[model samples]
Target chain A: MNSFLTAFFAGTSQGAIYALVSLGLVLVWRGAGVVNFAQMGQAMFTTYIASQLIQNEYSYWSAFVIALISGALLGALVDLGIMRPLSSRKNSLLLNSQSMRTTIPVIASLGILGVLKALAGIFWAGEERGFPAPVPTTGLRLGNTDLAITGFDLFVIGVVFLTLVLTTIFFTRTGMGLAMRASALNPEVTRLSGIRVGSVRTLSWAISGTASSLAGLLVTPKTNLSPNTLDLLLIVGFTAAVVGGLTSLAGSVLGGFILGYVIAFVNVYSAPENVFLAILIFLLLALFLRPQGILGSKEVRRV
Target chain B: MLKVSNLVTEFASIKALNDISFQAKPGRITTVIGANGAGKSTLLRTISGLERPTSGSITWFDEELTDKSVEAIVRSGVAQVPEGHAVISQLSVAENIELGGLFRKRQARGDLEIATKDVYELFPILFERRREPAGSLSGGERQMLAISRALVARPKLLLLDEPSLGLAPLISAQIISIVDELCKSTGLTVLLVEQNANTALAVADHGILLALGKVVADLPAKELIADSALRAAYLGY
Candidate 1:
């Protein structure tokens, strides 16, 4: 029972990290109508920036802030420099009749992933490095048993929850946030209504970048960091996003927690080596049951 | 007043708006009536800056609007209520309406409230259901929401594309009458694009007939309506 409790705590902690990364993916999906496969690359790169700053004796918060800003800039640059051109090309005469609208942006995002990975390799090489937890790592005692969740784990969960709350408020209450949401739904109508959807798209990417950087920073303390440290997390996050319904932010968070618990329980009951296979089976079952995702709206076919 | 001259908008190899030229005078509704392929929507799109014209000039109150951004065009008192009553279905009807005024400097929430109240005056049904998601609104209500949203910005020139696109004849007539009343009361200039020629011309003061991206005739609404042969040939009346 204690072991089960321990796994549950461990799963929730890990799930918190997945939620952060999943939120970033969901943001990009909503804003740009493109599933950004490059999220892991962006996260890895920004975390490295944070690591370098910390190595140079900068305070953790300062390093984190700087890394986040760098991530935002990187995301904006990717959208402006790479995604925009590809999008324009997709609309060009030769490609107008082509039915690969979804695939084109995806290919562009993959190119971004490659570029970020190469950049990280060139700058920092392929060394695995440990980053110290910003908060206390000592586990909370549960009736004399050392539980898996530490103070830092609690902090991560709190931060993820806080981020979700803030983003919810942003989209629901603020003007710009509403504009971003509306633009995601229909860019043409948004532009006609006097919103500069281009700027909104760029801003959405920047927000996603900042969230990804935060996710990277939070996850690195728990695991060793390398050039491709976040690749697995990216896949998990993508799965979570899919589980939550690709278009729904709240759904993504729920998906992440569900995935986290699944992995945790699986680790307890089955061989650790079977974790990936278990997750795949679970995802397959979920998708087979509900193709649009558990929380996704029914696809409205427009006339 | 809105003036568009020699506007040529091309999509790939096809010219959607071929040397289109027309004027929308202040305090009048100019209905651009055409068949589906006649470039009526394209003409409005070009003026609203959604589609760039290959060659032409659009002036709004003596200010050149060619090559300007959509937001810039809106700031210059042009607002487009796009085809299909394009309300942001996820947003509340009020939020969708407030989005109409987003081009202006960030107004206080109180100002937004007042602007919304004015729109409510125009669309009382929307006021009752302002808190609901726009998608929940009935088709006619959606059209009302769309028009009132554009009116929230209080623009000098209103560009409405296919306002009657998907509504029933009764609902379409209701929407047009409301628009005509709003135009008469506010002295607002309107450029209405429609495939529903009879209804559009009935409300409009001036009419321009379009055929395959070119102007077939530009005349007073009454004269155009009275011309039975022109109506039979182009409008299928």
Candidate 2:
């Protein structure tokens, strides 16, 4: 139980980070019917921006706020500049629009990764950059051994949890949230209901971007900084979503933590060469069993 | 009053509406009864701005309504209950009603909430099942919810596509009774599209018949219902 508690605490913090990314994934997928494969790239770029600001001696709140705003703006930009136009083409099937929207984001994300890599160099020599811890580096002592949970981890957990709670309330309680839900089910019906379907879709993108940025910024300090940070983090995040089920928020978060623990456990037991096996196992599980994950519900294809 | 002149529409190679023309008067119900491919849905979709007519003008109260978007048309006081029970499936019954009032920027919540309570008072079963998912609702229940959603918007002009599409006679009568009750209120215009010719004419003050996207007959509801030739040719009575 002691070992379990320690492992739980460690992975839960990491899961919170995954929860942030998963939340974004769920929002975009639910609202727009697209599987956003490049969520990590978006997050990686935002994380780079946060690190740059913090290293320049900007206030912590200012840095986080900048990242959040940029994240949301990027989300809206993607919808307005890319997805919305494709959707407006009257006869585009739902699947085609979804694929088109998702593919553009993937390509754009790859481009963004390259641009960020170059920008990171221009701004501060584009080299492997270091991250400033959002919180002070002090591990809580538990029975005199280093429990390895830092203040930053706690802050990440707390912020991510709050965001999820607030979002759940917004979706269930507010008028906008209800409209957003309606927009998800049927865009044409929502339009007939007198709601602007495009606006709701754009709002989803903005939200997805902001949440992804939050994930990137929170985890940046705990890991090495590079263009691929978000790219790698995204694979874990997507694994969490896939393992938990694509459209389930709760499943994504739970998947994130579950994946985190598996990886962390494997890192302790198996040689680094065999670590890729754990990820392969996660992907396989998503393909075979519980693909809709613990928190997710599966949608059937009409034959 | 509503007037549609030379309204033409196409879906790729097929012409959905071929120079369609008709009129619907205020304080009365106009019925458009037709076969499946007779352009009933297309006419309404064009008039309501969901589909753009290839050519011609749709004027409502002397206002040009051709080529406007769905939102613009709705904001201009035209509301529609779409075909095939287009109720937002994941939304709650109450939220469905709430959407009707979303356009009323000036109205306070007091009357609207009371109106919601009134819908519940009128349909107790719906109120009882208000918290449940709209998807799980019966066919008649979904129809009731869709019409109630439209009624909540408090539109001067209401367009209902197949209000009695799929339901038992009993449930159909219940919803039609609610729509009929609205007739007592002055200045309310409705364009009800249905295949149930008897019911459509029974509740309507005036009825218009469409065949092959053209107005085949336009007369008082009772007069058209009484016309055996028109009934057999278009109404399918």
Candidate 3:
């Protein structure tokens, strides 16, 4: 029983990390209608920057703080450079046709990805690097198993929980969040209501970027120190967004944790667990029980 | 008072609105009623700054508002309750209400909450289910939310498009009555657009009827409603 509980807690912490990344993807898609395939790269870039700051004797908290703000700034820059133009051109597009506009980001990210990859390979390639142990330890004794319950794990779980709660509060209690959501559904109507859809969209990118930065900063401490760390998390984050229902914030959080924990368990037990297997399972699940995943919304086709 | 003169809005090769002219006095419900493709929605879109007039002028309280953006128009005290599908399904009920008066910061928030209380008073159903996902609401409930949000904006003019669309007759009646009561209390001007000619005319003080983007009838709402010839030609039997 102790063993099971230890494994469960350990899994929960990791699941929280997945939720963070998933939340980031969901926000980007919701506000800008882009999948942000480059999210992983952005996170990787920020994570590297944060680690560099800490390694150079900068305080971890200050490093993390600077990284977070810069990540959001980077995200806004991407929006101004890429999303703003696409949105203007696609404003009058029909509902189904809007998805076609998504190609803009996908294309733009290719060039961005190349630039990032080259920079990572040239300047940042070191022997081995990791986060400055922001959380402290990684295990607690639970019967025979060494349950990994470090301060880092706790910090991650706390951050994810806080992020989710704060997001819910903002959406509910604040007027800005409301205007953003309203603008996304129908810009013209919200505009008529006197809401500045452009400013709302920009804010969306800012918020989502913060989430992305947190995920990268947190995840990199446990995993690899490569430039592609954020990239690897992308698959999971995108999966979470798809499961959660791309438009629903709550759905993304739930989807993120589920995917994270499920994959972790599968890796533990299954003999042939691979990324391909994960994709297969998700595809099957989407076909059968589509809306149960994170951010998922049931669409009732009006007659 | 609002006066639109020589308003022209074109789409590709077609003229959605052509040299349309009308006037809506302050503190009166001036409705625009026409057939499905008579450019009523386009005219409202233009006046609200969602669409720019290609080569004309829209004067709202004696200011040229034709070329401005939607946010500017709303700042200038014109708000629109767009079609039913425009409702943001993901937001909470209270948040939905809060967004209506968001352009103006201080008094808008406090006043909007008071207005939301009034909305709940008007549509008790909305109050009862104020915490649920807005998309979960029925068509009529969505209509109530849309109009209530617009009212919170505290606009000098409200451009409401197809408020009665896809709603049950009873529900439509309830919304219209609530709108009527709010207009009375707020002394707000409105340019309501609807294809339901008879019902729209009932709530409106004056009416403008359009055909293929041209004003075919400009008279009192009751006068147009009473004209059998106009009714047979556009309003349907």
Candidate 4:
């Protein structure tokens, strides 16, 4: 029973990090209608900046802030330099078809992932390095019992929860947020309403960058930072987003928690080696049962 | 006044608008009536800066509007209600209405509130379902929401494309009559594009009949309606 409790506590923290990463993926998908395969690479690059800053004796908080800013700038640069150009190539034969239009950007994002990974390798020498946790990692004590969750785990949960709340408010209450939602749904009508759709797309990328950066920073302490450190997380986060429904932000977060718990239970009851297989089977089951995702609306097919 | 001179819009080799020239005087309903392939929507799109003309110019009050961005054109007092009642279906009715006035720099909170109140008064059904998602609305209500959204921008010249596209005849007539009332009461310059020639010509003050991307006749709405031979030759009515 104590072991069961331990896995539950561990899963909550693991899920929070996944939620942050999933949130970023959903943001770009909703805003630009393109699945970004390079999300983890962007996160890894920004987290490395934070790691380097800390190694140079900078305060953890300051390094964290700088990394987030760098992430936002990098995201905007990617959109302006690569994604935007790729999307606007309407005259290209390869991009003229509807299926090709979505597929091509995804391929471009994969190319971006390769470039980002290569850049990180060149700059950081592709070395695995430990990242320090902002909060202590020692397990909390209650009376004579030691809880499985640490201060760092609690911190991760707090940060993810706060981010979810803030983003919810922004989307519901602010003018810019409303414009972003509007543009995502219908760009032509949004442009006709005097909103610059291009600017809004850029903003979406920036925010997604920030969210991914936060996920990177939070998760690095548990594993190790390297050029390819976040690759697996990206896959898991994407699965979570799919599970939640890519169109719904709240759904992504819920998907993360479910995946996190699944991972933890698989590790505890079975073996860590079977974790990936379990996740795959779970995803397949989800696809078969609810293809639109657990929270997604049913698509009304027009005859 | 909105003046379009020798405007030619081409999609590659085919010209959608071929040397289209017309004038829409202030405070008058200038309806552009045509068949489906006659380039009526393209004209509204060109005027609203959604499509770039291959040649010629669109001028509003002598201000050149040819190559301006869509957002810039809206700021310059031209708002288009696009075909198919293009409302953001996921958003609430109130949010959809708020989106229209989002870019306008209101001097005070009261200004925005008043603009919103006016739209609600015009479409009471929308007000009743303000909190509901726009997707839940009927087709006619969706059109009303789309119009209300454009009006919130407080545009000087309104460009409506196929406002009566898929609605029933009674609902279509209701929407057109409301537009007519708006033009008469507010002196709003309107360029209404429609495939339903009889309905549009009945309410329009001035009419331009189009055929194969060229203007067949430009006359008073009454005269255009009365000329059966001309209507048969061009409009196929």
Who wins the lDDT comparison? 4
Clashing pairs in 1: none
- Residues A1-303 of candidate 3 have per-residue lDDT tens digits of 654454566567777877878878777776767777777777777777887888789998999999999788878887887678755773465522645666766777666766776676677874346666565765755688665466777788888889788888787567676676677675666776777788888788878778888888888767768876566677777777777777777777777777766766565555334745875587569647775543354442110
Q: Candidate 4: how large is its RMSD?
A: 2.3
lDDT ranking, high to low: 4, 1, 2, 3
**Interface C-alpha RMSD after superposing true interface residues, each candidate, one decimal:** 3.7, 4.2, 4.1, 3.9
Off by over 4 Å in 4: A298-303, B105-109
Those runs of model 3 whose alpha carbons end farther than 4 Å from true positions after fitting are A1-9, A90-99, A122-128, A137-148, A184-188, A270-279, A291-295, A299-303, B89-93, B105-107, B136-141, B167-185, B234-237
Clashes of each: 0, 6, 16, 0
TM-score: which is higher, 3 or 4? Answer: 4
Relative to the unseen true structure, what is the Cα RMSD of model 3? 3.8
Q: Alpha carbon lDDT of residue A178, candidate 3?
A: 69
Sort candidate 4 into its docking category.
medium
**Which stretch of 10 consecutive residues in model 1 chain B shows the poorest summed lDDT?**
B103-112
* Candidate number achieving the greatest DockQ relative to the actual structure: 4
Docking quality band of candidate 3, CAPRI definitions: medium
Give the 10-residue window scoring lowest on summed lDDT in candidate 3 chain B: B85-94
CAPRI level of candidate 1: medium
Give a tens-digit lDDT track for model 2, residues A61-81.
898899999999878887797
Off by over 4 Å in 2: A1-3, A89-125, A142-145, A271-273, A298-303, B103-107, B235-237
